[model samples]
Every structure is written in structure tokens, then in C-alpha cells.
Target chain A: AQSVTQPDARVTVSEGASLQLRCKYSYSGTPYLFWYVQYPRQGLQLLLKYYSGDPVVQGVNGFEAEFIKSNSSFHLRKASVHWSDSAVYFCAVMSNTGYQNFYFGKGTSLTVIP
Target chain B: EAGVTQSPRYAVLQEGQAVSFWCDPISGHDTLYWYQQPRDQGPQLLVYFRDEAVIDNSQLPSDRFSAVRPKGTNSTLKIQSAKQGDTATYLCASTPGTLYFGAGTRLSVL
Candidate 1:
């Protein structure tokens, strides 16, 4: 079963501090990993995605993720947090299959303090 | 160019009632997907269609949930009998390349 696991349920950081949200996935073959963020009362927006080639991918809002095949991880990172960055972040994975069925993790809630 | 659209933004119903959610995908998207997002959880794939043909619906609750993408454009998801457990945000997404989601319809069954 292909699944994404976001070990942290909630993370709190002070504004301007570095932030990291961990994500681990369980899949047999190559994985198409993505990070999505949802603000309050808003739809989910794509942060970034990794298909192949480069392991480190940059996303919108100064966010980036490194896909480590050996660790089965694709953790999201930001150099400095902002108050507006407080939202729910989800990690998803899809296989190279034709269907493109996406599996998402429970999500991690980030709270930024000013 | 407009993004995916869904309505009604919110819906409340009693158990055993029937409700349908509508989705209008992006102008030329070939793929459309419906997802259910429970509170504090990730969005789960309910069903998906590729130009009027169901690409996959294995995760959909076949007994009560049914979806249709007539004319390969607009789509609808119907719940024959609503249940409290079905309360969640119903998300509609379309993609020609990368996926773009709608505002989502929040359903609550009491």
C-alpha cells in the first residue's frame, strides 16, 4: 500500500526562525512527491513537486523540499517562517501508473508566533 | 482563465437525506478528481474521471456514493443517504498538467 506519513501533528515556530516539517512515504517503486498547503477557509495549493532528476526542489513562498530516496523522505523546509505561513501542510505521493491515484498524509499544522 | 469551481460552498443535511455536489473543471482539463477531506486529515481520493470515463473509483463508497462527469466537462457527486460520518469537505480538482483545486464544499450531516 502506498502511503504518506507526516509524523508531526503540530509544529510551532517563532517568526523569522527556520522551520522544518518532516514527511516519510512508503512506496515500492518510483514516487511522485508533492507538498500542498491550505490556509484557513481556502483551497489546497501546490507548494512543490518532485518527479525525478533533481532531489532538491524549490516551491512557492520560499519553501523547498529534499527528496531522499534512501530515507524514503521528502521533508519541507523554509529558511524563515512568517505569520502568514501558519497553515496545514500535507505530503502526497503518486506512482507512475496511468491512473495517478494520489495518497496524502494526515497533515501537519504549523503555528507561527510573532 | 478560471480555476476549478464547486458549489454549494456549504451544505447541511440530516441523516438519510440525499445531497449532490457539483463541480466545473477548468476549461480544457482532461482529468477531474473528487476528494473527501475529513477534519484534521488529508484529502482522500473518492473518485476521478478522465474525459467522461472513470479512470479510477476504487476508493469511492459504491454503495452510496456515485459520481458522473457528463459531456466530459461538468461533474457531480451524489450521496444517496447522508450520514454523520460523511461530514467532510468535498474537494474538486482538475488538471491538464499540475492539479488545481476548488474552494471545496463543506458537508455536514446531523
Candidate 2:
């Protein structure tokens, strides 16, 4: 079965520090990967997505994610953390074939302390 | 684009009550999806439609849950008898390829 796993349930980092949120997926074929962030009491917002070409895809608010096919991972990264960047981040995967069911990881809660 | 729109920002109901949530996808998008998101958890797919046809609904709890995209533009998800375990945010999304989500309806069954 296709699934997404975000191993770290919570991550804390100081402002101005670099950030990385890990994600792993299980799929037999090429998968469409995505990263989304949800602020408190707000809906989710797309961060980035990867379909083909460059493994690293840029998204809004200086966020980016790299899709590593071999490792079945698509980890999200940010050069410098901002206090406002604290939010719940989710990793999702969807098959490129058939009904194209989408799967989401439990999500990683990131807290950036200033 | 107006993005996806969902009605009733919040709903509070007693167990066994029925509630419905509505969604209007972005204009011209053919695929619509419904997901249930528990507190602190990622959204879980309940059902999805391609145009007016159901593509996948395997995860939907048919015992009391039902969804419909009557005209392939607007959709509704109804829970016949709400349960305390059903307290969660219901999210609706649409896709050209990448999914676009709505603000969602937060349902609390007491």
C-alpha cells in the first residue's frame, strides 16, 4: 500500500537557523510529492510540489523541497527559520496512475523560537 | 481564481445529529475531494469525484456518511448520524493536477 511517513512528530529550532523536516513515502511507481503548511486555526497552504525534472522544487515564502526517488523521500527545507514560520507541516504522495489516490503523513509540528 | 470555497466555518452538534458541509471548487476543475482531518493529524481522504462520477470512496464511512457532486461543480458531504469520534475538520479540495483546498468546516460532535 502507498503511504507517507513523517518520522518526526515535532521539531524545534531557533530563529535564523536552517530547518529540515523529514518525509518518506512508499510507492511502486513515480509519485507526485508535496509539502503543505497549516497555521493555527487556518487552512492548509501549499508549500511546494515535485512531479518531474529538478528534484528540488521551490515554493512560496522561501520554502523548498527535494524529491529523492532512490530514498523515497521528499524533505522540506528552509535556509533560515522565522518565528512566524511555526506551523504544522505535512508531506503527501499521490500515484501517477489509476485513480490517483492521495496519502498524507501524520505531519510535523515545527516551532521556531525567537 | 476564487480558489475552493466551503460553507459553515464551524458547526457544533450533539451525537446522533445530522450535518452537511458544502464546497464549491475552482471554476473548471473537474476533480473534487473530501478529507477528514482530526486534530493534530494530516487530512485523510474520504472520497473523491471526477466530474459527476465517484472515482474513489473506499475510505468513506458509508454507514452514516455520504457525498455528492450533483452538477460536477458544487459538492456536499453529509453525515447522517454524527458521533463523538466524528469531531474533526472536513476539508474539500479540487485539482487540475495539484490539489487546491478550502478553508474547511470544523465539526464538533459532543
Candidate 3:
């Protein structure tokens, strides 16, 4: 079964500080990875996705994630985070073959303190 | 284009009561999905359809839960008897390729 794991339940960082949210996935074959952000009282928004080449994928709002195949990890990073960046981040994985159902992680809640 | 839309932004129900959720996917999109998200947890897939045909509904609890996409445009999910464990936010999403999600309906069972 394909699954995603986000270790950190909550992360706190100061404004303008760098941020990195870790994610790990489990799948036998090739997997499609994604990062999504959910704000309070709103739906989730896709931040980035990794399908094939270019291990590093950039996303909206100055976010980026690197797909490390060997380690089975796709960690999200940002050079600097703003107060507005506070939200819950989810890591999802989709199988390349059969069903194509998305599996999500428990999510990491980020808090950017000013 | 308008994104996926879900009705009844919030629902409050007593145990044993019934509740229904409605979703309208993006125009021209053929696939629709339903997910359940518990407090502070990830979204779990319940069921999905492709143009009114159920692709997979293995995770759905058929005993008291039912879903339908009659015309392959709008969809509805109904729970016959609500339980405390059923309290969660119900999310609807659509995809042509990439997934687009609705604001979701927050459900609370007392």
C-alpha cells in the first residue's frame, strides 16, 4: 500500500527564518508526490508536485520540494517564511499504476511567529 | 474556471441522526472524490467516481453510508445513522489530472 508520513506534528519558526518540513513515503513502484497547504476555515491548495525529472520542484508562495527517490523522501523547503505562511502542510503520494488513490500524511502544522 | 464546490459549509447532528453532503465538481472534469478528515489528521479517501461509475469504494462504510453521482456532475453522500466517530470534515475534490478541492463541509456529531 502507498502511504505518506510527516513526522512533525507542529513546527514553530520566526519570521524570515528558513523552514523545512520533512515527509517520507512508502510505495513499491514509482510514486507521484505532492505538497498541499490548508489554511484555517479553507480548502487545501496544492503547493507543488513531483512527477518525473528535476528532483527539485518549485511551488506557489516561494515554496519548493525536492524528491529524493533513493531515500523515499520529498521534503518541502523555503528560504524564508512569513507570518502569513502559517498553515497546516500535508504530504500526499499517488501510485503510478492501478487505482491511483492518493494517500496523505498526518500533516504538519506550521506557525510563523513575528 | 470555478473550482470544486461543496454545500452545507457546516453540519451539526445528534447521534443517530442523518446528514447529507453535496458536491459540484468543476465543469468538464470527469472524476470526483470524497474524503473524510478527522481533527488534526490527514484526509482519508472514502469513495470516488468516474463519470457516474464507481471506480473504487472499498474504503467506504457501506452499512450506513451511501454515495451517488447520478448525472456525473453533482454528487451526494448520505449517512443513515450518524455516530460520534463519524464527526469529521467531509471534503470533495475533482480532477482532470491534478486534484482540485472544495472548501469542505465540517460535520459535528453530538
Point to the candidate with the largest DockQ: 3
Q: Is candidate 1 or candidate 2 better by TM-score?
A: 2
**Candidate 2 C-alpha error for residue B57, in Å:** 0.8
Candidate 3, TM-score vs. the true structure? 0.98
Is model 2 an incorrect, acceptable, medium or high docking prediction? medium
RMSD of each: 1.0, 0.8, 0.8
lDDT tens per residue, model 2, A49-113: 99999999999999999988889999999999999999999999988997667899999999999
Better of 1 and 3 by DockQ: 3
Q: Report model 3's chain A TM-score.
A: 0.98
Error of 1 at A92 (Å): 0.7
How large a fraction of the reference contact set does each model reproduce?
Answer: 0.76, 0.67, 0.79
Task: Quote each prediction's TM-score.
Answer: 0.97, 0.98, 0.98
What digit string (tens of lDDT, one per residue) describes model 1 on residues B9-84?
9999999999999999999998999999999899999999999999989989999999999899999999999999
**CA lDDT, every model vs. true structure:** 0.94, 0.94, 0.94
Locate the minimum summed-lDDT window of 10 residues in model 2 chain B: B94-103
Question: Could you tell me which 10 consecutive residues in candidate 2 chain A have the lowest summed lDDT?
Answer: A94-103
Q: How well does chain A score by TM in each candidate?
A: 0.98, 0.97, 0.98
Residues A1-114, candidate 3: write the lDDT tens digits. Answer: 778999999999999999999999999988899999999988889999999999999999999999998999999999999999999999999877755678899999999999
Tens digits of per-residue lDDT for model 2 on B41-65?
Answer: 9999999999999999999999999
Q: What is the DockQ of each candidate?
A: 0.79, 0.75, 0.81
